[model samples]
Target: MNRFRFRIRFEDRVGMVRDVAEVVSGHGANILSLEVKPGEMHIQVDQVSPTVLENMLKRVQTIANVLEVTPVEWLPHELAQQRLRAILDTVEEGILVVDARGTVSLCNRKAAEILGLGHSLIGNSLKHLGFPREILTSLGVGRLSQQEILLSTPYGRLRCLVKSQPLVDEEGKPAGAMITFEKMSQVRRLVQSLTQPVMITFEEIIYASQKMAEVVALAKTVAKSDSTILIRGESGTGKELFARAIHMASPRRDNPFVVVNCAAIPDTLLESELFGYANGTFTGALKGGRQGLFEFAHQGTIFLDEIAEIPPYVQAKLLRVLQEGCVRRLGEMLENKVDVRVIAATNRNLEEMVAEGSFREDLFYRLNVIPLYLPPLRERKEDIPALAWHFIQKFNQRLGKNVRSLSEAALRRLYDYDWPGNVRELENVIERAMNLAQGERIEPENIILPEKNLASKSPSGLKRAMEEIERQAVIEALNQGGSVRKAAKILGVSHTTIINKMRRYRISGKTSGQWK
Candidate 1:
């Protein structure tokens, strides 16, 4: 059978495409594919001779509103495939495709060069090609996504990031899979260039309190070592800042310092994000897989913030990476060695979690190799003035404000209140004051504190009292400011937070008088 492609230009009226298809079918030609655009139809057909094709075009031209019909060298599908092949070949990354039965179907030149395979890899069974059985099993399972796997090829032990997706048939059944590959060395260079090093140094950690000073001193001391450091503190205690400072002080300061918030990423994706995945491991995964946070931080540091929030299943994998200095992507069994210093921070009490069996004791020990506890803002009250001035200076530069200093009354108000939100809260309060303050110095009125009456009444729990106070403050701010943005500015919070609080408190604009 011969193949032919036709480009038919016609009026973009309804049924115009159908008429073109009918003409091809009338000539005893089977339609391979059809693509319709604004005023043109691209059709591919099989079992048609040049004379038959010309006759078919003449018949198509006779249709009303049809302008022209021309034969092209390549069919639409063939041209698309050629373009795709050209694109894949041009890229430095390697591409591989496999059938559902684990046979190699297609591979680009880059793949052959990277894996040291022959030019023709089609129809070869992956198992027969000496691929690791575990990797083959993972491909068979078809659930892996963005995994990293080591391939022992003729080129040597290649640590490649592999990402795989299943090609489904019309019935939605698995037909085959396509994967892309990238060498770890290449990935490392890319990651290193993209990832900025930790700029916060030990000198940047401003503290006047002895407790904070001691913590900084310990962090500086431990920064010189390769031990895993666990930063324990309450939320908003600047644990990540300390972690960044430690990374800056380390010998691997020049390398990538990657940070991953365990609580920010969903549990389903956290593993693959940290360990990466092999190509063709799962459906809809990125081509060539991706380098996980651990892999990206190889030869440097990875700071896992909110470490206690990591799910139990991922905890075991993390423990392995910590102990073995290597990580295996979600599906592949081969481990890629990494040289990374881990710094995990958590506001939750891991010891209590271990006692309750919610957190692994072994993992805790591995993470808590050198424990550094940061004092909360209230505990380090003496540092409040300095931190406040520092934030004032920062905001002065950031917001283009020239507020000179904080009033004694404002300082006293800050000192009097127990900062449940820690240093982060203080920074926010200063920023808000800087934005709202009309005078050169921040006054007590400029400081947006929680409702003292609500706080005085609710002596039962600090957290509950703080919430009540915040809710009341949001209500009052909305009433006074008359707009969400204005209220958010007055309350030192985001407009989204103000809107959320209004919803949570069941307060409406009508009740607050008016909303702009």
Candidate 2:
């Protein structure tokens, strides 16, 4: 089709456009587009021969108030479209704009690449891409929505967040829809940084015992929720680790994971730290009043470790945050809302503190919503062998040593000792052993425990105590019976059960009175 663009400089008058339109119509050509300015007008028309275009331009020049007419190849709208296409291609996300009839009028390079389509996406119906016709119609007519949905394309199935905006005329009528496609994977990676996360999951807790297994299962179950969680354990039981693991497993994992050690901060600054102070509230405050940990944890989890150590005044403020879903600055009276999930942990007895009137009763109840307990290391000796090897491998890389594993006697020493400091103490002991070991494996002589932690009593807990008793009983019976069968008779169980128990406890001997 022959299309012509003309730039006509005309006087600023009302009837100038009507005269030009009548002249263009007189030449049997259709006016494709028209743009008018203060002293200039740009118009494009199609289906005009070169001779006819020359005649039409001469007639338009003779019209009143039409000063100069110049024929051009590109109109202002065409130039604008080229710039818009370039800008849309520069965007990282895919951009696709459809007209009111649901036909794709504009699709950037990224959009075609993501959809595994050729460069030609225009004139294609969005309904052909498997989008529901009714939904596309609604979006085409300006009923916009933002949703994360699964879409199948020529490349593969994609999980994307689709956002739409209505293209409207000057009178607010729908002209088309401008839709954007953002791959959810990129968004997740952006939200949840690969290297910066705490990187704790339930699998990393390193426990093989049934008690710890049950605890891990419960933790994983509760990780799906947004409720407040209170992790109860003694010092070094990995309370903070559990808190981080829970946060990583939660739906809010993509957002922030703010951690505050209540015991580490002084009581005087606790309130200001948990709830930020207003500007100039104190002598050395931030210039524009920094946000508190709660606000910083918006849309994510805030781990308040050593929760029992927070002062009574801070407890009341924290209670306000939990109960009201909001926090007030230290000096500011306005309550700022936050969509944060709280996971508090403590190594101390909160009930005892409440009874002593050192902690708030209301705050205690609020924090105790979902209580998860982590057993002390001494109580779960079955995990010792695994935990020892885990740390052995860890410190091997850090200390640049090649320690293989702990010796049988070294493991027995660890299994027998009472661990007051729990898993943290075990890690320290293994590190020491890793440094002192001369051979491939850590031996009894290389493993050292704090003299105070090593007691004549065996590892605590009914489970381990019973296991120790059964282990000794098996050794004694083996010494007296001199055979598995006779030992089974002595223990009042089947020989299969005896063998299994002995194997489980790592007990074995060939000669009588020489059981190890």
Distance from true location, Cα of 254 in model 1, Å: 1.1
- What's the TM-score of every candidate structure? 0.57, 0.58
After superposition, candidate 1 runs with Cα above 4 Å error: 1-156, 160-183, 195-198, 453-516
Cα RMSD (Å) per model? 17.7, 20.5
Give me the candidate number with maximum lDDT: 1
For candidate 2, the per-residue lDDT at 205 reads 83
RMSD over all Cα atoms, model 2: 20.5
Model 2 lDDT tens row, 72-131 = 888988899999989999998888888887789889998888777766777888887655
Candidate 1 global CA lDDT score: 0.82
lDDT of 1 at 119: 71
Q: Candidate 1, residues 1-516: lDDT per residue as tens digits? A: 577777888877988977777887899899888887899888888887889877888889999999888877876677888998898799888877887888887888888888786676778777766565655666645755655566778766677766776677889777777777788777877867876653788888888999988888888999999999999998899998998889888898888788899877876788999998866678987655666778878888899998987767999999999999988887677787888999999988888778766689999999999999998888889999899999999998998888998889999999998887888888888998999999789999999977765434335577778888888888889878888889999989887677657645556655656665
